[model samples]
Target: MNLLVTGGAGFIGSHFVRAVLADRLPGLEGASVTVLDKMAYAGNFANLGPVAESKRLDFVPADASDAPVVGAALRGHDAVVHFAAAGVTGIEVLLEAAHRLDIARFVHVSTGDVYGSIDSGAWTERSPLTPTTPAAAARAGADLMALAYHCTHGLPVVVTRGSDNYGPYQHPGRTIPRLVTALLDGRAAPLSGDGGRVRDWLHVDDHCHGIALALLEGRPGEIYHVAGTVELTERDLTGLILAELDLTWDHVTATPGHKTGDHRRALDDDKIRRELGWRPRIEFSSGLATTIAWYRANPTWWRALQSE
Candidate 1:
């Protein structure tokens, strides 16, 4: 099968590409992949270094918003897995291009943050979008646009709302990598508002696996939740990082956070598990350990990104 994966050089996208090339994901073995990436701040060529020699892999350094470019590259692909963080306009163009190409499956990878902050109970696929942050609002808009394509145009599309992902190749600005890199440099990691904001953490490997399931088995116009088995607050997560690094609270610097914004989030993944038989396989502690070790062992990979 020929596959087009946008933002395939970014953290989660790169992981998905590597998984497909390694035959780790079901239904995509021996597939040829075409990657369209903008090579932005988070997009790095080194992320695909492991699969650099794969004959099935093709790289296109371009923006997803470029309809002419995307349409030309998307031809003859069996499916499109969009992992790019293109705003509403870019998604519209890409979805149109994919629809015109008659792609078999268009999987739009999204985030749990689109549900905003849920004080209690996990957010199901039917949960109302109450985005609080600017980023969340933008994602919510994109999700709506993607689903609309399926409803209004009959373009086959499936959406997966994944929880916070932590693993190698993640940009250093994210919570886990930022803290890990900071602690590695013997610097106090910055914490916001007593570090009590809650997030469901899913390992990048598990996230990609869930997306693969959704891509292969999910129904059109449906949304799936790919969530972690465990949930942790910012304070709890920071504490775990400190423990992992053998540091104390003194190594953390608390900063003020939003007072009126949503502070907690969790997802109900039962639907995906029941319908597609998908479940997160990585344990949080073990996954955290492995991720920390990855950053520790590869300083050069992340050191240059720290300034950006």
Candidate 2:
């Protein structure tokens, strides 16, 4: 199979690409992969270094929103896996171009944030989208548009909503990497509000594995949730990072947060498990320790990122 993968140089996208090339993802072995990345702030070519020279991999440095470029690239591919931030850019152009170009399958990756925060139980795929932040709202809009295309134009599109992902290659702006990098740099990590906000964290490998399942087995116009196995409060998560670094709370600074909704976020992923037999494998403690080790050992990779 030939696949066109958007944001292939970003954290999760790169993980998927490498997995496919290594034949780690079931049902996609020996697939030829074409990567479309804009080399944006978060997208790094270095992320694909391990498989850069693989005969099955092709890298295209361009924006997915560029219609002419994307439309041309979609011509002969069997499917398109879009892992870019579609809410902010490119989902519309890619979906329209996929329709015009006759691509067979399109996987539109979204985030659990679209469901916003829920104070009680986990949100199922059937949960109503009531995103609070502007970013989440934009992602919600993109999800609706993708489903609409499936309904109106017979496009074979499947959407996957995942929780907070952390692993190697993640940009330092996120909570895990931000705190890890700050503590490494002998600086205090900032925790906004009261540090009570809670979020479910999914490892990137698990997220990509679930997405590969969605790509292979998902029904058209359906939505899948790749929920995290563990949920942690902001303060607790920060404490994990600090503990890993052997630092104390003095290394953390309290700051104002921009949250405007409920303090907790969770997702129920039983649908994907029952329908596709997908479940997360990595435990948070070991996964987080490994992640911290990656940052420590790859100082050159992240130090340059920090300087930028």
Candidate 3:
């Protein structure tokens, strides 16, 4: 298969590309990949360094919002696994181009944040979207557009909504990496309010694996949830990171006025597991340790990004 992946230089997209090239993802062995990335602040070419030399890999540094570039990139690819979230414009452009090319499958990567905060219980594929943040609202709009194409034009779209992902190469702006990087620099990590925001933590590798399954086998116009292996509050997660680094609460400082929206987020991933046999293989404990070790050993990578 020849796969064109948008935002392929970013954290989750790069992992999918590396896995495809290395034959790590099942059903994608020996598949060639064309990566279309804008190379934005979050997009790092270094994330693809391991698979750079593969003859089957190709890289295009261009914005997904540019129609001419995106249309040209869509040629001769069997499917598109879009991870770019520049805006709804980019998604519409990709959808139009794929529809023109009659692409086999269009995997629109989305986030569980579209469901907003849930007081209790988990959100299913049938849940109504009630996005609060600008980013999530845009993503929710894009998801609807993708499904509309399937319904109106038969574009064979499959949407995968995943929970929060944490792994190496994630931009330091995110919560896990932010905390890990600060602790590594011997600086205090900031906690918002009481630090009790709830989140489901999915390893990036497992998240990508679920994406692959959805791309290969998911039904048209259907939505699948790729949930995390563990659920915890921000305070508890901070404690784990501190324990891993042999540090204490002294390294953590609470900011009184800061507020991060969404008190809790949880997803029911039984659909993907039952339909596609997808399950998260990495445990939170080991994944956290390895992620911290990665940051410690690769200060040059994260530090350079942080300095920019």
Query: What TM-score goes with each of the models?
Result: 0.97, 0.96, 0.98
lDDT for each of the candidates? 0.92, 0.91, 0.94
> Which model, 1 or 2, shows the larger TM-score?
1
> Taking the tens digit of each residue's C-alpha lDDT, what string does model 2 give over 235-260?
99999989888889999998888557
lDDT (Cα, tens digit) per residue for candidate 1, span 88-192: 988998999988888889999999888888889999999899888787787888899999999998988999999989999999998899889999988889888
Each candidate's number of clashing pairs is: 1, 0, 0
How many angstroms is residue 200 displaced in model 3 relative to the true structure, after the best TM-score fit? 0.5
Q: What is the Cα-based TM-score of model 2?
A: 0.96
lDDT, ranked from best to worst? 3, 1, 2
Top TM-score model = 3
RMSD of each: 1.2, 1.4, 1.0
Runs in model 1 deviating more than 4 A are: 258-260
Candidate 1, poorest ten consecutive residues by summed lDDT? 254-263
Model 1, residue 60: what's the lDDT?
98
Q: Give the TM-score of candidate 1.
A: 0.97
lDDT of candidate 3 over 10-77, digit per residue (tens): 99999999999999999999999999998987899999999999999999999988999989988999
